[model samples]
Target: MTLRSEFGREGNVWLMPGGSLLSAALAAALVVVGWDVVQLASEEALARAAKEIGPTGRLVLIADTQGRLPDPRAALAGRPRPFVVAVGAGGAFSTLADVVERRVAAAVLDADRPFADLVAALDSLLRSTPVAHDANRLVARLRQREDEARRFFGLTPREQHVLGALIAGRSAAEIAVANQVSMPTVRSHIRAVLTKLGVSSQLAAVALAHRSCREPTLLERMREVHQL
Candidate 1:
């Protein structure tokens, strides 16, 4: 029989050239348990990766030093069980430390390093954690949160922009300058964001926004993959 028939369509479960069949199974098991690597170069790529992996998987995201990274909480909002490892330049890590701390499982900031260093970090992380249990419970909780966030904080484009800036810890004056608006206009947008998200202060608004936006779940990802 040919390799295609032996392994089924897409060949995801098949052994690679010069690799053992057992190693393939082990890799598949890691994916199922939500331990995988995602390399990102832009916000769009990060979003795509997040959608593919879902929430329960452990992700080691290697970001290229080019574009802005997505807000980790928003990028991971749809996931039911979220664990992330962010790898990037030192400046990137420092700039995003708060979000990283809140959202990612770990962060490795070594901009000048080679790709081998990233692989080593991922290996160490996988060996540290046991397999996750109680996926169903986590999924249910995630679904509830998703519903609530969508209902309460479904923001407009402008609001989303404002929210993004707020989460990045920009001041009202800075937001005004960046968006080419008056400080009063920025404050108004901030108030609107707070009202829509049902929060009291700018910090609370940022926190709510972080917790609300996320990519698709694993089941959703599977459906997309199968359809493709």
Candidate 2:
């Protein structure tokens, strides 16, 4: 299966090589769950890696980092499941180890993760995500998703803009200036977003908006990877 297909389910998402997502999934599945592993990396790389790990799933396309990651609040909106969602700064998860604290059902960040740093962070995170039998992390994550979905649905474009700004940790005045709108307009947008998102406070608004965006494109990832 492709990265999207393999990891579409709920699970702890980590910060690592985009290709590693596929590798980890397959390794966890076939090796641990008695099934074949799928890969989403380049054909040559997959072929070479297959020799090391063995093949199980077919590749539909080379990895394509499409869409920006959902705002942190939005990450809570994704369907309930445990999976890692890594994103680089330009659009990748720098260090989602904490987010995936075993209890983290999924990570929702950028798509421009650095190979070396990502691997190191994920290794460390694997140690953190609660693995205890009594942990209810997945349940909490599911609740978060429902909450985010209810908040963002039918939000107007301006409301979305306002929420996006809040997700950036911007102040209402800053949002107004950045959006080139009036202060009242920004506040109105904020109120509207709050009402729609079912949140009573602005801080909550910012947190939710952070998880709603998706990953950036491959081109965008490359630019960010190079600090371009």
For model 1, the run of ten residues with the poorest summed lDDT: 10-19
Model 1 root-mean-square deviation: 16.8
lDDT of 1: 0.48
TM-score of 1: 0.37
> For residues 29-136, could you state the per-residue lDDT of candidate 1 as single tens digits?
434444442333344555555655555455444433352334455555665544554444423433334434444434333322333443455446555553443544
RMSD of each: 16.8, 12.8
TM-scores, in order shown?
Answer: 0.37, 0.41
Worst 10 contiguous positions by lDDT, candidate 2: 54-63
Among these predictions, the greatest TM-score belongs to: 2
Candidate 2 — which residues are off by over 4 angstroms? 1-121, 125-131, 135-137, 178-180, 211-228
Clashing pairs in 1: 34-57, 34-58, 55-79, 55-81, 77-213, 77-214, 78-214
| Cα lDDT, model 1, residue 174 | 91
lDDT of 1 at 1: 8
